[model samples]
Target: MSTTTQTAYLYKHAHPFLPRTIKAASGIWLTLENGQKILDATGGAAVTAIGHGDLRVKEAIIAQLDKVAYCHPGFYQTDIAQDLATFLVSTTHGRMARALLTGSGSEAVEAAMKLARQYFLEQSPPQKSRHHFIARQGSWHGCTIATLAMGDFKVRKAIFEPILPENVSRVSACNSYRGMREGETTEAYVARLAQELDDEFQRIGPDNVCAFIAEPISGSPLGCMPSVPGYFTAVKAICDRYGALLIFDEVMVGMGRTGTLHAWEQEDVVPDIQVIGKALGAGYIPISAVLANERVISAFKNGSKYFVHGQTYQSHPAACAAALQVQRIVQSDGLLDNVRNMGMYLEQSLRGRLAKHPHVGNIRGRGLFWGIEFVANKGTKAPLDPSLKVADRIHQKGMSEGYDIAIFQATGSAEGGWNGDHILLAPPYIVTKSDVDEITDRVCRVVEDVFTELQERGDIREVDSRVESRKTM
Candidate 1:
């Protein structure tokens, strides 16, 4: 078969320009069909935790296939699924009592929304008025309609606004770098954000709010920004006072990506509901889950005892087996400790290399997850025009020869819905010191070269001047 013909049949994510064709992937590297090797940074949207090809996960899947692969989730119970649920619950240390396995992060988020609504419905007093959800301004929950409505990622949500639910509202994201004002202490910043949330609840009528949803560490939409100290505690307090559930979407940062097994562990507050994915199955299979706290679970148990939600592949045996083995490997190998140690090294390397760069506005993250936001003016933190596509250029440059690295790119942070760029780097947890060094060096080179090329062509000076003009005005 002809190469062009082979590529022509598959529908690509982007149009006019086809993505690189991967021949094979193994251990943090992807080999293209043309024999170019690309380092798998960002882990394909922070999904590949243990790396590309692990024999253990493959063997576990095979073993499950030998037993039974398919079963109706509503009719029969699978032991592998049960064990996987138990393992996930155990990680929460009794904070969460039940796990509803879903096909992807979007499904899990949808489930969380439904579960939150159901919990209120099942309550003794039946607060059916609680139908609204409050999410942060710069957030990316998922791509589905309901999840998109809950998220304020402008690029994806703007066109669908007319069709999306109006029940979701937004507040400022807890991004100290961009959201915090000058001369403001971290305590003051936290207090301000908390008050904004409280005011929002009051405006909406506390009884009308079903939950307040947020990512423990802001993901792509906010450039991997972690909240300031006491942020989560304050937000949780507001939710508690309003009789609303707190839902943490750990889909991108959970399951050992953030140096801890769960990102919430370091936040000093436990969520009433949690959505976990990506690293759970380690990119070996499609899997995600929504965990319900004891309070929410008990309400259902005492009332209807039915979730009213089920997917055809909800508890597929093979997926559960794959994820179970992935978790087992994470625990037995003590990868979380490695994540902590290597995370410090990665942060140090990034700061040392990019902190003083004119275009690099901020570098923030935890564990293996990090994001470098780009700006036209570092002092003013003015975002480059979205048309420049700074992050996308860096990502493309990294894939080119002499710098074969894969990094995640995102925009829409400078403003709530648009006008910012950032590159997210989330290497595999199995990365070593040498690996970190190489990845950092390659990423630094790509960022420098892309900006250098843009400057040589006078592309950036125009954007910077425009931003400066806007700021002065």
Candidate 2:
């Protein structure tokens, strides 16, 4: 296909300046129309856990299509949907009771928010104080108006601020690298962040809060940063004290991306409601789901009214069938084990290569989901100017070098709302050791090339000067 045709035919995620037109994809590689082979290092925003072009997933989808492709959940529930729900609940130790599927992660988040509000109505007092949702400053739930307003990133919400919803309060995120005070212990930092959450609830009036939503492992906004130990335990305790539900947005970090079936599994905290997507179906088909435990389900079961929200395409048969097979493959192949092994190698490779880079201020993540934070100076921990768009430049360079990596950037995580830039690297769970090595090598080269190009263009001083400054500190 011609470049113009490819760009126009597809509602491209971004503009076509850096054209990445793919003719086909298989086994972690995409072939462009120009015959360039691009290694999918980030798995298209960490969605491809089983790698590209899986025969089993394709077969499942085909089989589902033969039976039914589009059946409204309101009118009929297919057997495939029921089977997928059973599989998902079984994977969670049968603790989860009900499943509500959606077309994407954002819809799942919206459902969770709505369900949390509905659950409050079923309470003995039928609390009306549960209107505000307290989310962290650097947390990302989804792109819906409710989710966007709950997040700390200002750029995405700037254009639609007038139409965005109100009543979502922001608090300091559980990012020790950014929010923790100097000389603070891990436990102290956890307590401090939890206290800040509680304070927000108090300021909003405890009775007016519905839930505290967060990602178990930070995605995009704070660069895949996981909370310090005991952080979630403290947060859960505070939420219970205030009668607010705790919602975990595991859309990016869950589904074996973090060496476990769920990122919250590693944290030892159970959420009242959990939102999962992306790798849930491994990108064979679009699917997302929200799981409610017995407590949350009981509220709905005992309530007089029906759960008041749903999508026409909720639990699409083909999507659920593909997801069922995708999840089964993850278990049968022991891919979570692979993620553990490969994640260690990936982490080592990243620290080994970029640990000393002048701009790489922090390298934090768990399992296969990693992020590298960039900075203008190490001593003051100041970010590069937002106008530079350093992350965007690196992404383009990396793509030109035949690697598909997503650049997750956010300003405001460092000092305020416009001072941070970081790129997230969440490779598929099925990535091999060789893939890990190549990813690190390509990333290091891209970082080097971009800095050199910037210096040549007189964008900044010597690149190594920042590295040297970091060493002295």
Candidate 3:
């Protein structure tokens, strides 16, 4: 394969420059066409939990293919799908009563949205008014139009705003880093965010809202920011008061990425509907799931006895088989413990290396999932100009020849502003201390070198001065 700008594959950005071609991947590393090795750091958007090229997962998938590759959900029930759903529900300790498999995270989220709506309809009174969803600013649910309406990432949602649904509205994200007032206690911050959520429900009319969706620990759009203590407890209470379901979009943070099987497990709250993917199959196959708790399941069981949504690949045999084996491996290998242990080391290493850096505003996340927010001014927390593309530049530097590592670069800003330029560093749950050290070393070098080049070009001084001037203004 040759790197070429001209290709039949229509690229996401359609860049004029040619893209690097990966020849193969294995064991937390990628080999390019030229045979250069690159650290598979972000696990291709935090999907690879067991690392690259695990033989066990491959064997499981091959076995699944041999048994059965494709089966229509409406026609027959696959034992593999049943086994995987059972495994998923068992992991949730029966909190989620059933799992509906889907093709990707977007499909899972869309399924969750539909389930939430179907839940309201299943009620005795049939709450037809409960059609709207309330999601947080800077929160990302998925890429579909309904999910986009629920999500507030301006970069992705801006283009199709005119066509997106009106049933979804936004509230401020429970980001103590961004929304918390100076000198405010964590309790106070949590209360304020809860009140804001409540107010949004009132504004939208409590009966008109079906659910309030959020990520337990934010994903790409929010830079792995977890809410302060007691935040979800308060939000749950408000959701209950309004009779709206609480939906947790754990697509990126769940499945052992955040040290726990489910991110909500850390939050002390069980959502009515949960969306998860990315780490489900550990990148061995494409799979995502919408998990419905007992409350929602019971509602459907008594009413229509059916969920209104259906996907072509829902409950796919091969996908579920791949996921089941991945989950078993995660448990068999005790990788969640590794995640916690290695997560601590990764956190320590990153903070020790980058915490005091002038551009690093915040380093927050749990377990193996971590993120570093870049800013022009530390004290004021003013974001570097979007034009600076600090995170993108660092990503480019990391993927370059000398420093060969791949990271998930992201921006999380309210209303398309130039605020949250950050990069997520979620190594696989199987990463070791050595892996953490090397990942950190290369990551630090990338950030340091990118800024150094910017400084040499006098860009850092100008950004700092411009942000400082605005602070005064």
Candidate 4:
């Protein structure tokens, strides 16, 4: 079939360039229809953990289909579903008591929002007035209406603002790289953020706030930025003081993408409601989950005895089976250790190679999840023009050129959601030292080549004179 005929029916996002059509993916490489073998560097937005084409996960799905594939979640329960739920709950170490499976991360966040609202209604005092949610600036919870209201991703939420709920408010994200002041200590930064949240609660009326939702490790919109030390503890304290639930979105950074099983574990805080996806099913199936703490679950059990939420495929047997086997392999093969070891190696290699690049402003992340932010002036931390689409160029070059690497690109990470540009690198947990070396090499080359081309074309300008002056000083 002609390319035009094949792509005519598909409606894709508007872009200056069209993306390649992938024919197949195996392990950490994707084979494009044009005969290009590209390395899967970011796991297609940090989704794949165990890598592609696992025979065990395939067999598990087939085995599940042999018995039962589809069943109404409300009327019937499947053993595979039950097993997967149990496994998810156990990961929280009794902090979370129940799991609600969903089709994707957005669905899980939507469920978390509903559960947060229902939890307040289920209380003895019945906090019916507590319907508002507080999320951070530059946060991306999801794309659904309710989640869009809670998120501050301007590009995605701008047109939908009229339809989105108005009960949500925002606070600055705990992004130390940009949020921290010149002389601010980490403790001071945390306290400032906490006070900002407290002030927001007061403005919105604490009694009207149902929950404060945030990603343990900031995802897409913030480019994998982690909070300062003691940040979550301070935020949790504020939530507790105001009697509001704290929801953690671990969709991108959880499921062992970080060194820990759960990103919040490193922060020393337990969330009232937690959402996990992406690597949970390791791309073997489309699945995500919402895990509620005992407090939230107990409130529902004591009041309604139901979560007041349901989907036709909430607990698909085959999806659960695939996830269960993926989790088992992760544990049996000790992949978390690999993630930690290889993560250190990758971090060292990246910083050693690209940290001093003229446009590289910051490089930060945990375990296998890393992000490299670009800037027009490193000294001033000034971002490139948003119109330049620096991150998109790097991503396109990596794929099209001989680099043959796939890296995830993100925009609007510096200030709210406008000018910042960054690329996120989240390789599969099963990646080895050699794999990391190749990824680092290709990434460096891509960035350097892209910037060199922009400079030659006079499309890029020099750093601000003030920033250059500061460098001289």
Candidate 5:
């Protein structure tokens, strides 16, 4: 690609010298300008669920465009928007009766936070309490200011410390790999974390806490981590005791990415408000929504006022149309079964191929979302320094091998403020067994090749820098 041509847009996430200019994309594969075929294993941040160039979704968008391209939310509601709300509500199994559509996941999260505040204002003891939100450390809700403030990714939050909202609090994430004590059993770990959350609520005064927000399956930020047994049940109990709402963010792992339509379903914990995105429109268009349960809705339904948030593209006709088609296709085509089967295959393949790799510390995931944690030593569980850019090297090596994967790097995971890197894999739901095999094989090859290159350059060291895992404290 010429510099002049690339100058049309400011591309981030990579350097200008090694730009991977894409020309066309089709089911699970992308064609580069240089004619290199790249397998899109990560689906460009796990957004492409039904795969690229899906004709059904394309037709749906075109049909919607023919009818109407846009409409204001406050004035009128279209059928597509209404139908999507109905479909989303039905999927919630009556736990949620109404929905609010947004342009993206961050907007949905922002709306959810406001909705919680509004709900409290409408309840008895109205305006009497609750201005704080408790979120788990290392969990990612979104990038918007409020969402970022609501989360506790220490590294990501460090730079914006001065400007972030002050009413947000954080608890230790339920990452079994890092949260479980040296000799503690899984049950003990759950009980401990649950107790800790309860303590935090009480310490802050239950009436002063608005909600407990979390990612059902922790996404890229923490390597697709999930809570251990009894964690959600305990968390739910504490929230109920405090009269705080539970908000689940399924931006990256929802909409059938986790076998179940909603990631929270597997845990058997129903949240009062659920934020869903990414796979919602299957990358065909930008769309997201917040599902509010009956209890929360009652606060507004019985109140004298309506929620005062709005976006120009809220419930956009074209985006909603595309998502509606994706939903129908997912159900009619029975893709959830495929997700379960392929997810199992991917997990088994990772264990068989890379479990014993000296530098590969952990392989954890569910459904189509997987993560490979890199370490300096497996037994001691030492992390590669952030300055070494181990995750970026592996990702570049994978790209060299014609595979595109996302490597999410976070500081403060290895220690209180130390950095750790992990490469995340979220393949399109339509991935076949062969695709899974190829993905694992390529990932393994890249990991080995990167390590070999480091050794050749005398960059692989024997220095001792072991520290406690971030979540333990």
Candidate 6:
């Protein structure tokens, strides 16, 4: 299984390295065919909220399969699908009127975009001109062409720029780490970002906009960066003033990833359209959703009476069943409480171990999701050279035979979105104090070793990375 012959037929993302074969996985650990047990620190890109293998999730999937696995979504409405949708809507406490489930976050986001467009098209008097979208910088929604156009993830969407939609625009992201001015308070920063967004809306002609989309807590693009205080409140006000919808893409931070059912709950700003994924299935299956509030639902109800958007697998019974069971387990186990308690411990442990490290530029995130940024000069906060691939190096090293740990790597920050690096640690919700200690220790070792090797080679830290100087908004 480890030999090249086994992977000859597959095309991999990192073609230079063959992916490891997992013999089994359970409770935050992956056992390789060679009997190597790798610690899963980042929960497979922050998706495995519950853990590696749970009999409860397995039984749910099996139960659905036994009943029925595939049926035309257009022809029949399965009980499991209805139950899951109802469960999701209830989590919103009636704020969200309906849940449209899909196979992935990208699909849900695409649906949200279409739903926004249709919402305006179906309005009284029909505001047909309202089709533009204003998204924040350093944001990542999805991979589809339209979703790509709305995202500020520079590297992923650069080659497709010519094919992307022209109706999308960007405002400065609310990144306090690099975007905040030296003397500005949180209120000033929020106001500044709000003004920038308002100006973008005016620049685009307010009547032409459909929605302002953002992540409640930014995922990979900004490396788990949370919004500055009052940032979302101001943004929401601007969106309301323009009569445009507000979309919160919580694909990577929602569904108990951030110690709550929704990341927006902590912000106290309920979004009109909320897109969620990742932990929705807790790695038991692939499922995501677009939740629409009553305003949008009522508009569709009064007008078209049906969403124009549909997929062959829109309400797949098996997917719904799996996710329903996953959410149930999260609730039954009271995992959010664990996420809060363990998350605090994980933060304290990481800061204690790596805060003073010379190359560690920033440590930020909430709940179990934490990001550690690396830089050549901690004082200047200048990113490490993208050419060095510091994040990739650390991630690969962590996954290597001796290290046997997995951490999420991120890049694409700074001007032009090309010269920054960080690694994320999002251990499972079931992790305890001991697990946190182990994860923190392994992460610190991996980060320190990578930088140490670079330092010894006289290749980094001797000079500030030539990427660019920090520019404050």
lDDT at 63, model 3: 91
- CA error at residue 184 for candidate 6, angstroms: 0.8
Q: What is the lDDT of residue 172 in candidate 5?
A: 86
Stretches > 4 Å off in candidate 5 = 1-5, 11-18, 401-412, 461-473
Candidate 3 structure quality by residue, lDDT tens digits, 1-473 = 44453564675856554678788988899999888899989999999989888888888889989988998998899999999989999988878899889989988898888888889899998999999989888888888898888887777777788899999888888877778899999988888888888899999899999999999988888888888889999999999998999999999999999989999989999988889999999888899998888888999889999888777888888889889999999999999999999999999999999999998889999999898988877887877766677789989889989999998899854223335589999888888899999999999999999999998998863244345332221
Query: In model 3, which residue pairs have backbone atoms overlapping below 3 Å?
Result: none
lDDT of 4 by residue, 356-412 (tens): 999999999999999999998899888887667889999999988589999999886
Better of 3 and 5 by lDDT: 3
TM-scores for all predictions? 0.96, 0.93, 0.96, 0.95, 0.94, 0.96
Task: Give stretches of model 1 more than 4 Å off.
Answer: 1-17, 462-473
Model 3 TM-score on a 0 to 1 scale: 0.96
lDDT of 6 by residue, 199-299 (tens): 89989999999999999888887898899879999999999998999999999999999999999999979999999999999878789999999999999
Could you give candidate 5's per-residue lDDT for residues 1-473 as a string of tens digits?
66765665565544444577789999888888888788888888889998899898999999999999998988989999999999999988888889898989989999999999889999865865787899988877888899989876666666787798998888888888777879999899988999899999988889899999999888766878877878898999999988999999988899999888999889989999999999999889999999999899988888856897888999999999999999999998888998999999999999999999888888888999888888876887777766567888887777764445433333445553345678888888899999999888888888888898887887864333454333233
lDDT for residue 2 in candidate 6, whole number 0-100? 44
Worst 10 residues of 3 by lDDT: 464-473
- Lowest lDDT 10-mer window, candidate 1? 464-473
What's every prediction's RMSD, in angstroms? 2.7, 4.4, 3.0, 4.1, 2.9, 2.7
Error of 1 at 200 (Å): 0.5
Task: Write candidate 2's Cα lDDT for 242-273 as tens digits.
Answer: 88899999998888999999888998899999
lDDT of 3 at 342: 95
| lDDT of model 3, residue 51 | 88
TM-score of 5: 0.94
How well does model 4 score by local distance difference test?
Answer: 0.90
Whole-model Cα lDDT of every candidate shown, in order: 0.91, 0.83, 0.87, 0.90, 0.84, 0.88
- Residue 438 in model 1: lDDT: 95
